[model samples]
Target chain A: MDEFIRIEHLNQRFDLSEPWLARMIYRRPKKFLDAVDDVSFGIERGKTYALVGESGSGKSTIARMAVGLLTPTGGRVLIDGQDLHDGSLSVAEQRRIRQRLQMVFQSPYASLNPRWRVGSILAEPLRVFRLVDGPQAEQARVHELLEQVGLSASDARRFPHEFSGGQRQRISIARALASKPDFIVCDEPTSALDVSVQAQVLNLLKQLQRDLGLTYLFITHDLAVVRVMAHRIGVLKSGKLVEEQATEKLIESPQSDYTRMLIRSAPRIHRAAS
Target chain B: MNGEKSAWQRFLASDFFYDFKRSPVTIVSFVIVVTLILMAILADLVAPTNPFDPGSLNLMNGFTPPMEPNAFTGETFLLGTDDQGRDLLSAIIYGLRVSLFVGLTAVILAMFIGVSLGLLAGYRGGWVDAVIMRIADIQVTFPSILIAVLIFGVARGLLPPDLRDELAITVLIVAIGLSEWVPFARTVRGTTMVEKEKEYVQAARLIGLGSSQIMVRHILPNVLSPVLVIATITLALAIIAEATLSFLGVGAPPTEPSLGTLIRIGQDFLFSGEWWILLFPAVTLLALALSVNLLGDWLRDTLNPRLK
Candidate 1:
């Protein structure tokens, strides 16, 4: 199995300290929060690798680092065997690596720019990557993207505010897919949507992945979502990757107490006798 | 075609338009501002006489009362003539043109400088943010008028004696622009800080767009609503500041008299028997400033979601 994306010994430390003057007056030492503590993971090509953790467990930090949005204090991310944060890489090389990956942010409300129309939003990545030629071609590509995301071509004329949360999330997915990326970092993509809407979005994501042969770095706190979406799961505890295994194997017989607790705590539906 | 029509209809039905229709003060002020701007732009064609031309001034027509024939020339002045014998209505019209021009150019200059600096500070934090914001903070400590006056004085002193009068308006615009930029920079910086944190901005960054591209393409649009509101309010302030400088005899020169210079000339005869000399131009300045201020206030309230 080829590793499509690899995060090696990643660490992120944020200085959470008061001003220098205040610290000196109070005689306090500088403080830091280790958000991601030397976590290492690799996702196989055409597979969903989910990172499960509660809030503040550094799930989003890893997600950000995976997508090259944040530079880690230590360690490096490699995409398709090429260093993503390599200072030696030229601008064109960096852009080439960046073009192969995209991010689907958690909040549909915040992810899509409010001022932009749906057409422009979808066209942005296409235009940036030079995926299409001419305005007519761009419009046609935008229309195709909208339809692929289960939206009408006419919907492209509307603003993000005019769409429902699920529809907006679909638009975000469409935008992520616009660049025709192989690897997508979905940082709790359905976490902000309705429970019913979440299932639909998850299904759409699964369908897209199957059709496109894409790899995913799925970040979420919900075990139920993990059970349904992840091929392999990495359970995180306070910035550390405690356990990682195949989703079913981990769910059936977890090695770590933390993984066991997580599985047990997840709500189950009782079957009714007919 | 149908979509475009509905979008237009939606705009007409938006809260902004609804608010505009509901408030009579906003309506009146909007009308006043539009009328004043149009009159200023069309001053050359609209005014009965070219007040700036020395050939057009008749010494015998000086101090002619409103709508009354002069005893010597039997010429009737609409608003009444100043001591210089320039037609008061025409002078007011031309004065308005100068004031509006200075005000507009000064605001544009301030907005350009302020928005750029603010975008830089907010998008690039740490030392870059610190340097820009510290300057803004220091500038904010002094009254804007004092800063304007200081800049105006230094600029005037540096210019050649012969060029002083010619460059006075340009210098005045720069001074007021420099003074007023603090507010715009401060506002934009605050907005940019918030906007830069948004996921959309992060998304733009993820696309390998340069920092400048993200700042200009993604973050700038998000931060512009407040900037526009600030720009509108600052226009009124810039106009008032220009007038204040001119009134102090440091602003627009006597040759090309702005409203402030007209008021200065009018004030000389104000204490004497010729009261209309002071009254008409003063009234015009008041109306222009007040209406712009009211329109700006309306815009601020309307555009700001917090206010709504």
Candidate 2:
């Protein structure tokens, strides 16, 4: 497989210790919580790698680190085999590396800037990266991006509040796509939407990936969601990647007890086999 | 192509505008504020006399009562004349201009200082937050009037004697401005702290925006609503503070008396037979302050998400 992203030995530790004054008063030692404990994974070009875990399992933490939103205490995130966190890389080099990757955040309501119109939100990355030449080109590209995300061109004139939850998520996806990224980190993009809307968003994401030939790091807690979206799966348990396998093999025959439990807990509806 | 709706038309269509229309008190307050502001802006044209100009003063016309002519001069005064024979109506109009000037200038100064400090403290966090917030905490303990007085005294002492008298209003503005900033800082810091945690800020960071850019562009707009509410209320407070300082004779100079100074001048005649001199300015001040406070209260309610 042609590896587009390689996250190796990623360790993220959060200092959960009391303040200096409190520590002195209480006579307690400093403490730290390992949010991501030496995790490793890779995603192939033009495929979805889903990281599934329960809340507090550090799935979102790893997703943030993969895109350099959160820095790892140890190890490296390699994009196209280049060390993303390497100190020797100049700022421009680092930015160039980041330009190839983007993230669609959880909670579309909280993700998009409330004050900005849809056009400005989608146009930001294109302007930031100098992807398009002028304002006219940027406007045209924004309209095209909106259409690609299953929204009308006129939707760009409206505010985020004017859109439904599902529509807002589509706008967020379009924003991520503005930079023409190869690898996108989708952090539970549809978790906040209704079940029916979730299916629509998942299908849209799948269609986008297929059409754009894009790779994705899909982070979700729902096994059912990953079932249709991901090509490969990595199950995380308390900041540790417990199991990694092809989606079909892992689900057909689970190795770990946690993975087995996750599968069993997902509600199933017996459908008429087509 | 069809003609587009104006920004004003859209603004009038918003929920905020609906709220404004529904509340009679807010509408009345808005009218009062606009009337007062217009009167202040057009003081020279609206006022019957230019009290600031020495030529406009008539020593012979001093002590004339409202709607009556002076005993010796036979000149009629509408709102009566002061000891210096300045037209009471013109004096109040001119005083309003100074009062509003000091209030608005101080508020702007305070907002700028406080909002910047708050953004730095909240975004940077750790030691910076501790330092700025601690200073704000200490300032919050003292009565703002006392702080204004202390700042006024220090500023007055630092300047050259010739410039001191010349720039007393400017010094008062600074003193009141400095004292009022703690509220702006505290409110903006609390708002900035919450805004920084939002995923939009994190997304901005992911896009490689600098801390300053994110703070100014992304976080600042989100936090400004509360700050605006604070500013409106603080404008009322700033006006009152300027009045207090001037009443103490440390505010606007006698040559250019503010509402506070006019009230102070009137207090002397309060015990004497001449009462209208003090009554008119006092009522104007009361109306101005009350209207502003009520408007601010309405804004606070409208902007609050919990209320919605």
Candidate 3:
């Protein structure tokens, strides 16, 4: 189906052992939690594919596995049709795959380095990839990136502590865009920000997707944000993809009961009394 | 026009600088430490007579007392001369230089070894953590000075006896540094364990950052505040420990006498009525250690969020 990223039959089981007292009380050997039990999905190139779910629906776990931050118990993740678990793929190839699928974290305040200035924060990836020459050239490139992200070049020298919550989130977006990747997994990047700032960031992400031809795997519990930014949405529940449909189609006619409940519970402005 | 007031305001608004200025004891202690540090640094430019120079000594000026003219020579000894005809004022400066150097180098060595091990233990857990923590615990059961002596002995045993006296100061430093590292390791390990759970470290890992980058760039900076405070306190302890070791007659060579060695030499004439020999160096050593401990205590209060 012309997919850029695909996860097939993923299962993540964590061992939850009981303490000696609990074990004696329950008369059990061990317990196991199916954190993500057999979830599967795919994303098309140059589109915003979102996972909307309640807390602990394995939405974050799925995102974490997608970015190679966590290992799945049983599954295969294929990025650009290359199986990440295929024993033949070298470490360098896996790194290259990681370079493509970078994840913007959930908490904007917790994402950026507090000690680093705005400029060095952007230039870190460039220096890692050996993209720039010296400090002066790095500064110029960083300033340009900041300007593109709706920040002034003068703000480059300032520390992250100097910026507001919204401004810091924008700088994070700038850092994500620095590596020039094909795919980015934004894990609730605006959840910590104010609502008005959230809309602005969502619009910025949409504009960037259109201009840069980027693929986004957005994970969120907020359906309002999902409806605004997502072209297609996957309503995940209990570690499984319960409903998958286009954004407009899902809004028009949700076939699944869970999807309908989620849509109803989703915060809205108009026709709510109806 | 003023958005968040600025980080400087936030820093100033916090107790960091305000608490520093508020304490009179800290201010006085800070001044004393700064003056001593400057004196140690400019030992050559500030010292009146080069005590190291053989021609600078006058046997006729020997055994002079404070504020009293020498019976042998008419000129008075400000802090009084030793039995070897050395100026007490000039000797103390040289002694401070040696003590400061040894303390600083030992601390650096200990930090390097301890921090590296702590990172490995905390990051690469399982058996590695158990083994490192057990070793740290075992080391803690004994007094650090005894551990220093044991390590110092082992190190000296490895060298030929002829070089022992020659490398006396070097061996003492290495021994003290190795002994002092257990606290640093334990402190860093606890800090690294907490920091590893933070979201920024996970973000760094997700961005294809290497494990080393995650440790140094992300984890190390967060872990360093506690370590810095510990290091500051440890510097004072290390200096005092060196003095104790030297006073026990195993530290710096007699020719290049540290404060402890001067005290050791001065102890010989304390009963013979030349009390200035021991009194001056003892008082100077007391001042140095007290000032450092005061500053360290002030830093501990300032840097700690709970205390703040």
| Model 1 pairs in collision | none
Whose TM-score is higher: candidate 2's or candidate 3's? Answer: 2
Error of 2 at A266 (Å): 0.6
lDDT of 2 by residue, A220-270 (tens): 988888888999999999999999999888888789999988887876611
Instruction: Tell me the spans in candidate 2 whose CA falls farther than 4 Å from its real position.
Output: A269-274, B1-15
* Model 1 agreement with the true structure over B69-126: per-residue lDDT tens digits: 9999999988989887999999889999999999999999999999999999988998
- TM-score for candidate 1, residues paired by index: 0.96
Of candidate 3 chain B, the 10-residue stretch with the lowest lDDT total is B198-207
Q: lDDT tens string, model 3, A77-116?
A: 8898898667687878876777777767777777777877
Docking quality tier of model 2: medium
| Candidate numbers sorted by lDDT from highest down | 2, 1, 3
Per-model TM-score, in order, reads 0.96, 0.96, 0.91
lDDT of 2 by residue, B1-308 (tens): 12297888889888999999999999999999999999999998999999999997888888789999889888898999999898999999999999999999999999999999999999999999999999999998999999999999999889999998899988998999999999899889988999899888887888888999999989999999999999999999999999989999989999999999999999999889889888988888999999999999999999887988
Candidate 3: Cα lDDT at B121? 84
Among the numbered candidates, top DockQ falls to 1
| Residue pairs with clashing backbones, model 3 | none
**How many clashing residue pairs are found in candidate 1?**
0
> Of models 1 and 2, which has the larger lDDT?
2
